[model samples]
Target: MSETVSPPDRAHPGLLGQALALRAAWLGMDRAPAAIAFAASVKGIVLLYVAVFLVFCATRPGPGSMLIVALGLAGCAAMPARRTLVIGLTTLLFIMLRPTRSEDLSDFLRRELDLVGSIDQRILIAGAGIAFLAFGMAALRLQSTFRETAPGRHPVLTMMLVFFAILSVALSGLLPVEFAAEVWLFLAALASGFWCIAYALADQKVKQTTDPLPRAAFFRPFWEGPTLPIGKGAGFLAKFEAKDDTALAVTRLKGLKLIVWGALLAGLDAAARSLLHTEAGLPVLTDAMAAAARGTPLPAALSWASLVVHYLLDILHLAAWGHVVVALIRVAGYGIPRNTVRPLAARSLAEFWNRYYFYFKELLVDFFFYPAFLRWFKKYPRLRVAFATFCAACVGNWLFHFMGRIDILAVNGVLPGLRAFESYLFYCVVLAAGLILSQLRKRRPKPEDGFLRYDVLPRLHVGLFFCLLTIFNEPIDAFTIGERFAFLFSLFGA
Candidate 1:
């Protein structure tokens, strides 16, 4: 019997296998009650605070503001029964302490309208307070009276129309300059929180309660980015909120992981910038584009390098900031998805878009794509998809960017502002076309295809497409469409 006995054979795991094993182990902790308890315990909170402080030291999203948010989350955790009230009060305090739009509005008033000291800091604060009150009341009314009903059925479209109407009146020069200036200031306040209010209104349809506190909490919530609703509105937050102590602990642990990951990304971004701009001496993308516009083009190879490096850097920057914001949301006990996923792994244009800037895409789909898809070209399935893609990817994209640059309108008036937006409009059109075709394509890479064709080639094509598309996605308004085209053409030795 001893002679017949043999040891069991075990295969050796390679590097990739080891990595996968580690990832599995990491994920396994999320389901373990002891791990959850540790994450939710006081020790866990203290460790989290230390990690957050270190990360914020590197990234610097205003230490004071971050402290306020941290304390607010602690309060919410301590008073779970009054979480909404805590969130509402916290959001109000955060906005009051760091009013996002007040400084811009104040600067505009002073510089453009020559209203220096006419609208002091106190007035600006008062205006913000009034704007919050008005928008909050409007959200409550919409939720109670018009949830899934007429007029409120398309809250985003309604909001857009009203916004444009006000802007039109302000730009008409029909009213006295002082009144127009006042109107512009009011519009700025509304525009600042426009998307937040729209999200709140949209959530009303699915919500059971018309609570003002939840609506107010979502108005530029402490965890949200400047414009995008990272966790979306109340409906999404409610849906994703931790159901138990264990779940809350897991969510918070995940949040800590994200913050650390984001800090790494921030470091990577800084290192990349140093390598490209300092060590290798690559020109800034905007500056290079401006030089090309002025008939002083960089060498074709250098231009190409600059473009690629800039695109990669932009992705890192976005992903880093988005991760931090989403991490904060998760730390507050909401297990929301990350804002940017692994975009480089995308093998198709639509997939890339979905991964690249998730919340922005969601904003478009919620406000533009679904509405157009449901209401138009119902009989023609393909055309319906194409049209909806156009609405979301082209028209909606254009409008969102336009609204964000309302200050340009104040500075340069309507025509010049529109002219400055030409390049971005072109970018959106090409992007929409690419997305539509990607959606309509029937054949996709399969495993049976060789590894290179099935995996590597598609990713390469997607990467190339997005890289080239960035040629026209210039953020600086100083350059014209012609100049952008010139830079693109010069990349090929034109």
Candidate 2:
């Protein structure tokens, strides 16, 4: 079995739940040939990076532009395999700056707006022309290996999409919005590029013909599944249906671990902001928070309201962003289980997460403590599995700072520069404590008194959830949490 999870023929149309709807056969090949998956990922990311950068250079911003181009090209030359290396480099390029001041970069970008001026760009255009000629020949010559044997189609639309995409990203930092034409053109390019890539992935699936992986995911018991010994590898990740259904619970259990952790994360962030007001360059909201933070006077009526609103808003934001990336990854062809938000919708908190961010539940299940439990399960059995699972998850939860929480801290001005890292570390400890305490109190399985029925009631859940979220996490709200939540609820006519 390959790592490809195709859309099942019988996929449920209305499930709307990614985990429920998505099923993949267990891949026979747990490991692909020599980093094949990595290579594909890298290639797409690099091609995407290059495509964007080339367009940026075309704008010819300044002498420094030459340096950015040179480094990017050098990276490409060194990592021609077109795998994780390129994509990681590019994605990290954007991500690594969360705590740093981007004002300078933005100003510099404005200076370098004229990609149309760079001599190097002229050289690149010439090179692209030559490459197009060469690709046409290769298309005709080694058509079998290099080109898909599908019916001849120009895919010019995809090309234009890519062009606009590359241009949009390149110009976004380089120009002022006042230049309406350039901005519009750049956006058009990005939209086109994204569409083309989407088409390309779809085309790959169609052309492969034979289904390499399963149409459904498998759940294996702790003893049954092989130890992946890799990152995020423990979850009920759809590795093409490798094991028995009964042994593996339909989904992983760590889903609740992460969502509760995600919620506790808010408290952690609040503590950081409140406690480190000076280092964070602003006041953090609390009951005692200033009435006039961020130029807005706190409203008395919504003091308690905003706190709840903030938390729910955060949930929606996390869910929305998580799904977007998950979709992009699926469309791009990396069959990472849709482990983000869906798991959080469990009827019961546990079931909700299993349905929501299923991966974390699996992560807590397999990756974190499963290994340790694997050693003793024969002797300890139930106790070992249950105990180790949540413990390992606590440790993983504590480390959440590394993956994401830190960025939120910095962006929200919880901590400035390197301080954000330290602040997040502190918050994670508190969050872990919260998660551990919550886990210690779980009663034996009760019938699923699932999610509040509000979701099915004409989107009342969605509206209320987001309204609360918008109030608390408006990013610019600068209001106390209680106030935000209250303000959001008041907006409802009934």
TM per candidate = 0.89, 0.33
Clashes of each: 0, 67
lDDT of 2 by residue, 225-255 (tens): 1111111321212342213321111111112
Model 1 misplacement above 4 A: 1-33, 101-119, 146-149, 175-179
Model 2 scores a TM of 0.33
After aligning candidate 2 to the native by TM-score, how far in Å is the CA of 433 from where it should be? 8.3
Task: Give the backbone clash total of model 2.
Answer: 67
Best by lDDT: 1
> What lDDT would candidate 2 get against the real structure?
0.35
After superposition on all C-alphas, the RMSD of every candidate to the true structure, in Å, is: 4.0, 20.9
lDDT of each candidate versus the true structure: 0.78, 0.35
lDDT for 260 (candidate 1)? 74
Q: Model 1 clash pairs?
A: none
Best by TM-score: 1
lDDT per residue (tens digit) for residues 1-494 in model 1: 35776788898899999999987766676677777777778887667656655675567766656777766667766775666777777777655544444345446644534542466655665565466557656756775777566666666677778789988988888987767766766666676677777887777755656666667777756664765668888787888898887787888778877887888899999998998899988998887787788888899888888888888899999999889888878877889999899998898999999999999999999989999999999999999999999999999998887886677787888899789899899999999999999999999988899999988999989988888888787573777889999988888878
